[model samples]
Target: MSKVILITGASRGFGKIWAEAFLKRGDRVVATGRNLAAIQDLVNEYGDRVLPIQLDVNDREACFAAVNVAKDHFGRIDVLINNAGYGLFGTVEETSEQEARDQMETNFFGVLWLTQAVLPVMRAQKSGHIIQVSSYLGLITVPVLGIYNASKFAVEGLTETLASEVKAFGINVSLLEPNGYATSWSGDSAFQTESMEIYNPVKEAFQQAASTPGFFGQPEATAEAILKLVDAAQPPLRLLLGAFAYPAVKAAYEERLASFEDWKEVSEAAHGTSIKTGN
Candidate 1:
């Protein structure tokens, strides 16, 4: 049976592609964004199957109302993909306190509110999937994008724990980690704070990297991977999409190993166990 899906940030990027893919597969979709006009084409083409909803995830009341509306319209929401987010670019020192808070509010709290709103319905039905769209930076951090990275890292941690918490309720929570997808991430990357005399050259370099097209992973690629993950009989807890994510994760693992070896004695002492017997 085809499922009914509600995707945030459906006006563009991966969410738009995801809405199209789900509709293409004969599933009913509630495509949502702050501006419904952007998804007018989907509504025009798919008519009743693709319902374009105007919503802003950052708004708590709106988030609840949107979930209620989708549930009321579809009878049940088989999948809720939390895809509304943005990027922040700057070193930690250069980023403003307000920008950091805004990043977390949208990226972390927005997902949290949406999940909370939808989970009750899913729990009542005893089945549904919650897909939280994070970034590769969720697992690994890079310089200059500190605040954005921190927000994603918070999502990764929250979703990982939520997956375990919701398992018994017949709800599956998964993290979607896509690396540098050709979305508006780079172009949309906002500088939280104006550069002081401290690091103008470094700031410029960071801006250049943010504007570089070579690092973008195609949005369709992430969209397709998300479709596959959603369709799987047993979806993974974390789906790392795109080429950039894989290598980045691998490198992060290797770095962890190196760090562990360097602090073997301390780690062993902390655990109150000898290194002789391996678990």
Candidate 2:
């Protein structure tokens, strides 16, 4: 059965690709971005199957209004792809307070607001899917992208808790942990703080590493992965995309587990005399 899929940031990159894919598969799509002009072509190409709406995810009222508009137009929203976020490039010390807050507003709170807005509709229907486009950085960290990592980490926590809360309502929540993709995400779409001389070496290292061949995956492939997840009868709570994501995330968790085991004696000692609890 065709679905009514709502995607934010559908003007370009992975979001655009996903919208196109869903429409091509005969699904109704609500394509939204801050710039309506960017998605006007989709409406022209797909006709009534695509509804282009202007939405700035950071605006709480805008998020709610966008969902209402989508619901009114389509009568229901079967899936929501919360893909409206930008990368913030800077070390923790170099990023300003406002920069950190702005990053969280879009990447974390934006998802929260939109999800809250859609929950009522989904609850009434008794079925829906929410896909959060988080980053692999949510699981692991990079040197200069501290703020971006923090925002995604918060998303990781939010989506996991949400899955448990909404499962009984037939609402499925999933997180997509994608690695660096060959999208505008790191180009004009990225946000950067003022450069500090103390971090020049770190920045240079990252630049060199990013310039390496095949460092980024293609957005089309990521879109295909998302489609597959939506088609599954039982999708996983977390799906990692890109060739590097699986091994990278696995190694990160394994290493952390090893460190925890190494300090088991010390850790237990700290809890000495604590009452034993029943499982």
For 1-279, candidate 2 gives per-residue lDDT tens digits of 999999999999999999999999899999999888888888988999999988889999999999999999999999999999999998899999999999999999999999999999999999999999999999998889999999999999999999999999999999999999999989999989988899999999998988888889988887678889999889999999988888989999999999999999899889877667898
Could you estimate the TM-score for every candidate? Answer: 0.91, 0.97
Q: All models: lDDT?
A: 0.86, 0.93
In Å, residue 268's CA in model 1 sits off its true spot by 3.6
Worst 10 residues of 2 by lDDT: 268-277
Model 2: residues with Cα > 4 Å off, grouped in runs: 274-279
Error of 1 at 136 (Å): 0.5
lDDT (C-alpha) at residue 87 in model 1: 83
lDDT of 1 at 33: 93
State candidate 1's TM-score. Answer: 0.91
